[model samples]
Target: MRRITLTEVGDRAGVSRSTASLVLRGSSKISKETARRVREAMDELGYVYDRSAANLRHARSMTLGLVMNDLRNPFLADLAVVFERSVRRAGYTVFIGYSGDDLGDQQQMLSAMVEHRIDGCLLMPAAGTERESLKVLGSHEIPSVLFARHLGGAEPYIGPDNVEAGRLLGRHLRTIGVKEAVFLGGPSPSSARAERLAGLREGFDGRVELVDGGLTDSTVSSDSGSKAVSRLLGDGTIPDCIVAYNDIIAVGVTYELRLRGFEPGSDVAVASFDDIWIASQQVPPLTSVSTHAEEVGLACAEELLAQIDEPRQNGQKLIAPSLQVRASTGSWRPRKEDR
Candidate 1:
């Protein structure tokens, strides 16, 4: 099989080979019409660019790396999809690496990405990522934009406003007549969880009693939520409202309460974070905080590209969150005395 080359593309587009090469390299010198023609010709001929040869000649591999903690989480998965589309539109391809939510895997995958000569990285660090582990990329001068979680560094980061989300949930719970709220599932090592818990406390202004869910480790699952709630029940902590870490956990809590002959919305309200698809379709739709994963992903990608272009510019980007009211947590009007 004959391999299509730049010369063939140039001939098909009726442009000089130099012009076609410039278009392939994403050079700004080429006119829009000429670049479009060359791209069309290449597409028609099914011509794939030789990135390896180009990298050898030029110092750039023209590839970006995206390393996320866990793709199984629907939120992270959605972020990856949006980030992939945004970067691809910017004329750079992406290589996605999953850390499996382990520090060792995070470091290993980052090292591998560096070895592959990736231009820059978009990282969503694992739960327990330390400063030293992230130095692997920093020391190598590989630009990185941390998304969702950070390791308490000067690196650029973009994520939802977790504290604000927590506050919103807390405020909503209080408005719905939840004087005693229990947070089911977790003592996660992630900074996001701590910020969320803090915001929830702030929202209640020390008014609502927050009972510990009695979780030993950081695991966010339906079973974990159910188990935690069961332990709370066993401990004689009858919660007026149950707040789960995320929608999945909320679902478990709701299920467990139902099994115990309690009506979720009427008997005890339920609220959670990450207004995922399942949140709305539950037996009684769950009230949740909308983290806007897609927007966060777009911001992360843009920030990464900016860092790649000008590595000196680095800071944090916090996307605001909103509360989504549903049947699980009935809305109530604020009274003058309550205010």
Candidate 2:
């Protein structure tokens, strides 16, 4: 049987198809009585309006697109959950796409979002994405907000205070007498990595010898951390403490250290960012800075809504980071070097 069309409902209610469409979409311009008549006609005729088609007529998809650099990262995953919940609560649907730190993939995802006609976008851009692509988003006037990471010279963003997070980690290590420290980081251009390095340097203040773990693309993975540890061991430059980019890398560092007969907290301290669930479940647990993933996600959603409601508002928003000290940093004991 052919599906009942909107024309049938309009004819039954003595209204035009356009009027019926407007009523079904709950346009405020339509009278309540007309809307009720249209709805009743639809119910009586078993006519189901195509919502997607109706949204297209309004130049809206009633959907938001979320792009992430790494979906496997727990922090990003947690943020995705928050975004999904918040968008759904606002009567919008969410579509997620992962770019995997690949510029080509990022571009492709952006193209897909534009083609799908998403109302707005939330992006965690891949390191080194071309500025032109971000500019295109602005040209289209599609409301967008970067989350967890920001694209320089782009629109507003919401993320943790990475520099502060780095400083906090550096200070904690310094307090524990970590004179030689290694920072296991991902890509160089990543806003998070740059801010964190700056903060760490500020906190250390040349008191500790800093080693670069050679992560140059925001690709925080166990394999990268393991390889970094191997390189450090080979170079005979083991630091008193290691600060990993995220929980995944931290776990990898801990595993490699243990395999090499080194105890994580005692032989060399370990700290990381994100404070992911696995951080606390590690053999000795990990001391980390909490980036508040859920809050960041919610903030991104709210910012997108604000932009849609009022496009003139502009500027970035920063979320503060909090430190969680755990067993991985050796019980936070104070040494008697001063005494």
Top candidate when judged by lDDT against the true structure: 2
The positional error of residue 258 in candidate 2, measured at the CA in angstroms, is 0.9
lDDT of 2 at 227: 78
Best by TM-score: 2
TM-scores of all predicted structures: 0.78, 0.79
Q: Which sections of candidate 2 miss by over 4 Å?
A: 1-58, 216-218, 331-339
Please write out the lDDT profile of model 1 over residues 1-339, one tens digit for every residue: 788988899999998665677687677666799899999999999898889876674476779999876677788888899999998899889988887677788888899999888888998778878777877776556778888876666668899899999998888776666787887764357777787788899788787888657563466678878887777777777677888888878888988888888788877788889898899999888998999999999998888887765554346889999999998888333234545
For candidate 1, the clash count comes to: 0
Off by over 4 Å in 1: 1-58, 214-217, 331-339
Clashing pairs in 1: none
Global lDDT of model 2: 0.81
lDDT of each candidate versus the true structure: 0.81, 0.81
TM-score: model 2 vs. ground truth:
0.79
TM-score of 1: 0.78
